[model samples]
Target chain A: MKLLTLNFLTCAIKTCKTNPASFPLHPRDAELEIQEADLNLTFLKNILPRLMWEELRVISSELGLPELPATPPAPADLVEPSNTPLDTAEVTLAEGGAEAQEVEETPSQTAKDLHRILLETCIQEGKLVCGSCGHEYAVKEGVANFLLPGHLV
Target chain B: MLPTPSTSHVCFDRVYEPAEDSYLLLDTLSSPSETSFLQDRFKHANSSPPLVLEVGVGSGVVLAFVAANTQSIFGRQDTLTLGTDINSFACRAASQTVRDAIKERENGRSVFLDVVNGDLGSAIRPHSIDVFIFNPPYVPAELPDLSRHEYYNTIAEGKKATSFQQDSYLLQLSYAGGEDGMVVTNRMLEQVPEILSDERGVAYVLLCAQNKPEVVKARIRDWGSGWNAETVGSSGNKAGWEKLVIVRIWKSAD
Candidate 1:
């Protein structure tokens, strides 16, 4: 699962739904896989406002990745026209141009870091422990199993 | 705001690619009537964005289409899209599909897409979902065909299996509804009230003739006094035409 997905997930145990700690299920022994995807600035900027920034900061720290800013960057700053050219090499490469030189121009640091956490990082194996119930949901082959036992369901 | 038809190429063989039933559900969601109904609700809703979820999001095409249309067509931004699928490959494919769908939108709306690998909607917080969509495995099949071992074995052997054999494996998980094609859908229906937002929760479910849409609607209405069910859209011929219908359910104010 992508790290972005963990933001919305909470413990499924019926009794745990209302508990404050059920949310942002803590990842434990996570095995990370980084698969590079073409960064879509529009998507990154669009999704930033919806993210729980503080929750993500805590999770990112737990995963031992570079820390995200305590607060999300202003949406306008992340999507400024200047950042658009950072992906020119990708656009040209997609057009089948062999001479396209990789542009060293950097995107906003916030965009780069958010891209890494949201799109590139995949959790291949681990367990998501409920902060309240202490239930460990297994992650196998990048899929987090969220099914509860019949009684729990 | 229609979903790009290229999703089939992005979906892996094991992933449940968009099919006729999926399109029918999309049609129901994007139709002018449904869009207006949702828009009216958005206008009056409180500060929080409505949480929209799709259970069993195979290729994630349905949720992607809704997210894009909810903004581009309806001019509404207060909606967050979430999806879940039992297939691990599906979760990945869904995430990719959602990303591609909204990549070009210039709207400053906060469009959030998150996918989970879960059974039904098990990972979702109860009473948090404002709109729920489920297109379950709705084809009747023997119990053994639904086994996880059988599903993996079929995928391991590749896609060269005969049509009948293919139907018994991972593909079976997509279509094998079991016991009148309502087994999985029924399990989901039971959890609806618990998972749905108490104020104005709405659900769109896909059903075909064999599954008996009328029976399902009756069951949903019976779930509680406030629940109501109605057919929002239907496609194909009445006789043996694989007729699919989208059923909308919601709780009426007391």
Candidate 2:
């Protein structure tokens, strides 16, 4: 038991050095995450001229986002309206209530699903860059620590 | 001599004879349509004797136009125009062009133009320039094996090329983006605050291919709330393959 524990500790330390959490996972997977982190409405609008939408949709789906629609959503539908509107009282109490919580949980669940795909499929075996500044993180033993210097803080 | 075919949406008028390098570079001002394309903007702005600085002045085509236009406007040629480029060859060519243009003019020509060999904003006095124009090189780098004539021309000459050769301006102006494509442009955007003197006129940059406008906007957003950048205009590149965008930036005066 003593020998096994010593071996485990050595391996953990090696893991720490190799996985600086600043390196990217797989190049392709890391690329997808980088795009996801970089992509947004402001970026999308400005990038529309340079972006090939078909290519973006394909990449997004590969990273597990549903393929965006073929055509742009009309201006009126720019932000899709929420389908479910709960009563104010229920909405307030629901924050404290677990009753009929399933409906309320869908969006959060969807977000989690997307997050899991990003963390697992894209970032898990992939790379995690500094989301704040697009710095790539090295990975070791599936852990990514992106702690930066105080000046960079 | 004939009109060169332009890609969809691109509106260039004069296509120069193919350079020794075979790439068809349009002199955007060589023909009426193309000249009009650029001229219309300045005319529309309707500003008088504007303080203009041309970065990457190349063969001085744009500088010549501004000089001639200013002579026509001021009626005595009393306009302040400056052109700068990193390429010594280009600088020499521009200085000669200015001298020749001035010589050809009838007596009492009043336009004042200076050509400097250096990076943008370095040769000029601070807070003295009003309009800054740049058409930067936006080509991506090639693979190690590719060896074309244009590639050779684009490569900056090294010490071996001559007894004392400096870096080529083209090499300085061109970038392969960041490791992804935003790196060089990001650095350029940071210089905007230092370059702008007043908030009235905007600093204009013409970016090409996938990098220009897109990378520029992303860099500004990353810069946060202190500055303001806007995509004031865009046009089709002479080669219909990519769009050219004109971005205007301004720094607030506290």
Candidate 3:
């Protein structure tokens, strides 16, 4: 499973739905893998508004990944520096253009790093523990088992 | 007509084979009306791509179809797809189907999240899903005993794969809805309103004639003042039975 999946997943227990703490299932002993994929520049530029950055930061630190910025990057931070050689291609549109208006703008290192963490990283094996109940959902061969036991359900 | 995702590598003995109900979901989702509806719904300037979740992905033909045609259907290349299945075999097999189908597309790549092994949409966070879909067990047959799910979900001791009997049990989970075939569908319907995003969340559910599509739509309309359920696609009118139809449920912006 892509690490990004944790952003939208919560504890499966019915009772946990009402609890905000039930979200962002915490990973334990997670075996990580990186699978290369095509990066959508548009997605990279527009990802922050959809992301729970605080939760994502917690997840990254838990997984022992490089710590992220304390705050989410603005869309303007996702573009190449105007001084770079790539800027030659986008030089005409650099003047007074709002964020991401020019199709010619190249993605910055920050965008690539964000793309890698969210899209390329995978959790092959782990246990996702619910914060509210501490119930463990096993991740086996990249597929998490969210099936609760009869009594729990 | 869009190319159907191939399930050739899937073992039908354990997984649910693509059938009429599955095809109806594919056709309805990719139809001109649906495409236009979805595009218009998420067409805001630089809006984040919508998340598409399909419960009980079965052979993954439907999810894979949506992933491969995100540009055509969702009008966004970055639409994300996630799936869940109670049958472990289906979860594994369907993941491959989705990945392979996406790889086959030369361009316009979409993201595919992993397929979790879970019951229905229980694992999803509240108000997290933008577009949800289901082609549930609507056969009006007795549901298989789920106590054996863990055993059937995994290979027997010392075996290379699941036994023939276990395979059959897994396949049974794909259909067999128990008592008018609405047992599973009913449970899922109850979750629809809770799981969907309040802003633009929409859902597509496939129902057979026996599932009482009319009553289901009426009940959905009663979900609240803004809720609406409409049949957007159907096929096979033999014996006056709508063999299969797709009901699109959404909260209208009133």
**Lowest lDDT 10-residue stretch of candidate 2 chain A:** A1-10
Q: Scoring each candidate complex against the real one, what DockQ results? A: 0.23, 0.01, 0.72
Candidate 3 lDDT over A16-135, as tens digits, reads 989988988999999999999887777777667989999999999999999999999888888777746456546546655455444456778998899899989999998999999999
TM-score of 1: 0.72
The TM-scores, one per candidate, come to 0.72, 0.41, 0.94
Model 3 spans > 4 angstroms off: A83-104, B240-242
lDDT rank, highest first? 3, 1, 2
Output the number of the DockQ-best candidate: 3
Best by lDDT: 3
RMSD of 1: 7.9
In order, the TM-score of chain B in each prediction is 0.87, 0.58, 0.97
Question: Higher lDDT: candidate 1 or 2?
Answer: 1
Model 2 docking tier (incorrect/acceptable/medium/high): incorrect
